[model samples]
Target: MPKFSRRRFRQAKTAPHRGFPPAAARSAAAFAALTLSACAVGPDFVPPPAPASAGYGKIGASTESAAAAGGASQRFAHGRDVPGEWWKLFHSKQISSLVAEAVANHPDIGAAEAALRQARETIEANSATFLPQATLGDSYTRQQVTTAQFGSLASSSSSSSSSTSSSSSSASTFVYGLHNANVSVSFSPDVFGKSWRTLESDTAAAEQKRFQLEATYLALTANVVTAAITDASYASQIKVTRDLIAAYRTQLDLLEKRFELGAVSQADVLSERAQLAQAQATLPPLEKARAQNRNLLMAYLGRFPNADKGEAVDLSGLRLPGELPVSLPSTLVRQRPDILASENQLHQASAEIGVATANMLPQFTLSATGGAQATNFTSLFSPQTMVYTLAAEASAKAFDAGSLFHTREAKVAAFEQAEAQYRSTVISAFQNVADSLQAVKHDAGTLRAQVAAEKAAAESLEIARAQYRAGSTTYSIVLNAEQTLLNARLARVRAQAARFADTAALLQSLGGGWWNRIDETPASQAKPTDIIATSPIAAAIRAQAEDARDGR
Candidate 1:
């Protein structure tokens, strides 16, 4: 037989015997009933409206950030879509690699992924409530019975004869083995859509988990990038401080020679020595910060502090992104993970209201059992020994002291609470964007100012040193110039790093481009393991998790 025809034949042969009507007729009745009662109780969920504001901040705000060295003037292209791998915009291979590693190995990302999988599985388990449940079992029992128990004794009997009969009957007690087998099926129809409402709530919860997973991914990548930036900043600042110390030492030597030749006073030599000591003292703290940042980066990569495999990043290797994508306020709520997660919570709460409402209504269950019994195991399936039963049950709360009503009211309140939280999330998402935008703008101006100050200070120090060497100016003048120049260089390095970090912040605030991600699975049925190896990022994490599980 053809495959299609064979499947139809099998379905027909095993069709349920509902004992009331044909399966087709029962199905039609069920469909009609469902159509008539299709409306779910409680308020349907509607997404919160987007904010009315046009821009993240004041209207007509400048879109172009201030210009600084290294072409740090970033232009915000409104409505531009962000890429999934926003860190690549900095053009730093080391940072890109670190972020990739962090995404793959971070335990927090693994936890979030597991949570999303768990939620999906819960939804699957809950959905089974809509289907009929069946069970099968077999049993054998040995039992004994007495004829006297049935009152079969004659009334006109002598005591000795009756006692003799009773003794013989007790000695010959009837014992037999019985065998039984049965199949039972039960189903609770979703007449009021309670089961469906529960399923909906579970689906919404899974969606919330998916968004949380996305948020975790975003946070992990952002932290990795920021940590790399900080590490580079500290490295550059340490080098700058060390070089300034060397220059101070050289100036101290020149002062000592001049003091020996009576060309400068001993006080000048002591001042230069003190400045050199101050410059050297700055090294330990910067080194400490660098060490801390390295350890942090190692942690982000899911490794121990002593097991740092990450390469060092330098500020010179990073290029500031020229164009920045700024999502509109209207779209921010939809794109941000936290906002979307909150929306799912509101949806789950809405479904909970329906579930609670259904709980207050009547519930119906239909069940059927068929079996065979016999005194001997060989005759268990005989037609004469067959038995069957069919039943229907319904229950409703006639009076619950208003508990059901109050419970439903509580669900409504929870729904309202979720709605408020969703609104708050949207508002906070927009505020984050605003703060990042302002930081990017102001940090650019700060960098530009620092660059100018560093330049002027460098020129002043060079001129002062030349005058001191030519015996035309006091050593004090050169010492002050060197101190000013060192401070200026350190400030410049900070400003440069701030520009990069804030640019990353702006991208993160704009939702981290989750929409651009290619590895997203269907939220309802996907498991963390199903997609854990689907992308490079997830693959890395899965490999680490496996290694950890094996105690490698």
Candidate 2:
């Protein structure tokens, strides 16, 4: 009520202190001590040990090579590294170019890269908690106040010098502008390392996304190769079917002429025509399969279905790798993207336990608000208008019906789950390698058998056709011979393609040689240009448009 009381409060605020001001001195010393003593509450992560097994499986050696480019006998080069561009080992320029195109264009790769970037950005945001949060602010206002609001205090000061008592007591208003500017700061000291633990968890999560991006790259490239192989196989089948149709048509024509001359019966001509029809019937499905493969390639290259269906990769163009690379099982744990991803997940889960543990401890915060205010703009920063406040708060979880306890237990359980999943991933990786190793061995034997069978069937067909022409055998024998040869030829083509595909599978199972890559950029730092772009087909489509514009 007295001006003396307001003066006393301001005088106490500005009074000199002997040293650092007892309260502030104590808080600063305590903050330094806590900073020196604090440690992260959660356990630090250690990577899981490599697997115990030395090798995937026995690499069965074959003595005989099959009769074609993809039918060569393969040997295992154990402990040798895989190449980064493994597809190029096939020595086909088309395959290499197409795989490069798919890797550059695939949507899955872009999505993975974006996810990795987001995870990294979240880490950066969380890191801000370790530093003080400061804000600069300024404000202006127009204000009006009534003298009656101050009551007796306003009347005593102004009554004697100003006017009559009734006028002082009656409501009178004053209007003025108020100006304010301030810098405010708040900081929570990491007394027990909650922020550090959270950061560790986030860092591990970002690595998880990194490996996920690697997995996407690995899958996209491998799929492109496998799809190319399948396309080539389908193309071969279509060609074989077309040839069979032509031969059957010619045989039918020969038999019809013989029938007209009475050299062959009407039944013979009808049977030949039926065989020709059957051969023609097999053509559509093969063509459909080849077309579907083209559509799949279009998808891999990030093109529409109507986009330039690229030329089908020829099965005979692919040269089967003779010496297959087989990495040790111990190394596979580190090499495979899926296995590494699971390991990161396990690491993140471990960090989470520390975060949950830290949550149970006390948290401390210090905040200061300093500012100046004045009724007029010119005096806004004057000494008499300055003001400030200091505050300290400490909080701990006291009782929450055992909720924090269960939350920690849940985190521990999650860590164990991740550990189990990591082990499962390792097991699956080893199994894939073993299966691929065996496939490469056995596919050769299958190829050799089909080649022999095809040769014998061709010889039998020629004998049957000749004997029937000499009238010593019937058309049914020749028909059986032709069918057998057709089956043999188709089977041989498949067997040939399998060797190339299985070799690829083995390489993929060994982690696709990503570690040997020259560009070591992780997914988190990748630019948008690194993730997505138009496929080679885009250029082709543009060319087609230009051709149409020119009336070509």
Candidate 3:
């Protein structure tokens, strides 16, 4: 057992009754001793290993291409002039507004914001473990006592009668109230840094939540952009199909006239009518799909998932950019919020291990409580009635049913899991960027080829019309050429929209903008986009979001 000294508690007893100087001096001395003697028992925290190089499946993004693009020196690269408002690159005001609206009012985003607030509160709660706790209380009681006739009878018959005549022994009742007032302060110094490690872990968890929120936001924005593009593309396809149907109807009229005149077979006129019906049928479904996509966009914006009456979602107002920005390396990985969040989680897990190890060591706590007491309420404030108790405690687990050992093992496993997840996140992020980059590139090429095919089909249709007028071809030839051209035009529109969607996806995966958008550090730097890493921008957003949740 550790020895105790009176001087440690009642320092003023040895000297004159002064003010709080002696108490303060004793407190300082005790703190110094605790600081000097304190040592944490658990394993020290060390960040889990992250892959030196993220292993990404190649999709055309290579070191040579990145270097040639002037982003070679960067660890995570990206193209420049990738405007912060990337949605604007598609040149659609409606799309931009929808994306903005979704970010502001999305239900999932709101839930994530609430979770982040809870995480902050959790950190604050955990911080109390390092400080002392005290509670104040009071109570009152009443009691009554009665004399029994049996006791008097046992004494003597005359005595019992006399006692009864004197006084019913008088039923006695008493009431008393007790009021207790005291202030207690306790401190279990982190000699071994257990508290510090715990704080670290919590900080990391908070960051993870932050990044998750950011990732969700980015994905939602991308969806809005993609949906808008698809809607417009469908509309364009409908127009092309309607035009083709009109052309086929004209051809059908001419073919029927020729068949009546014994110039063409009934089969030829029938083929033209069938082709016209097919083209006309195509318009309704395309329109329906466009409407459906618009509803989906509204849903993402936290609006009711139903079509609005005359709700005009203008896809035609959007413009596509001529070229996609291409930067590589230091910019791409650094700005990725999810990857940074993963890093924070790994750090948090490392801290948890430290906290678990600290459990194995001796724990020390210092406490002091003082209050005045008296039977009479009037004397409660008198210094003469004051009483105090100050003590220190130290304890160590001598035996347990393998609980501590298992806890340490669990934390270790958690640390490893965090590490693996971190690496996987990094790898996946890289793959997404690479795939999107290649998609946009190849889709553009496909669009050019389709354009050429459309031109050829249109020429063929014109030639077939001239040949029919010259009496060398039937209406079926003209209908076939028009149909081929219509298909090519529709295909081109889809490829164009797909290219835009791919570009938006790449931007979202690369964390929304150029390298300047993200902070590259072992300790994550927060951003407006940061859901997990403590970027200053994200912090403000989180504050605003939490304030909204609290109805502030």
Q: Give the C-alpha lDDT of model 3.
A: 0.62
Q: lDDT (CA) for every model shown?
A: 0.73, 0.74, 0.62
Q: Which of the numbered candidates is closest to the native, going by highest lDDT?
A: 2
For candidate 1, write residues 400-439 as lDDT tens digits. 9999878877877787678777767777787788889888
Could you tell me how far off, in angstroms, the CA of residue 88 lies in candidate 1 after the best superposition? 1.0
lDDT of 2 by residue, 212-322 (tens): 888888888888888889989988988888998888888888888888999888988898888888888888998898888888888887878898556668887777776
* Residue 521 error, candidate 3, Å: 23
CA deviation > 4 Å runs, candidate 1: 1-37, 58-69, 152-172, 466-474, 520-552
lDDT of 1 at 490: 97
Q: Pick the winner on lDDT between candidates 1 and 3.
A: 1
How many residue pairs clash in model 3?
24
For candidate 2, the lDDT comes to 0.74
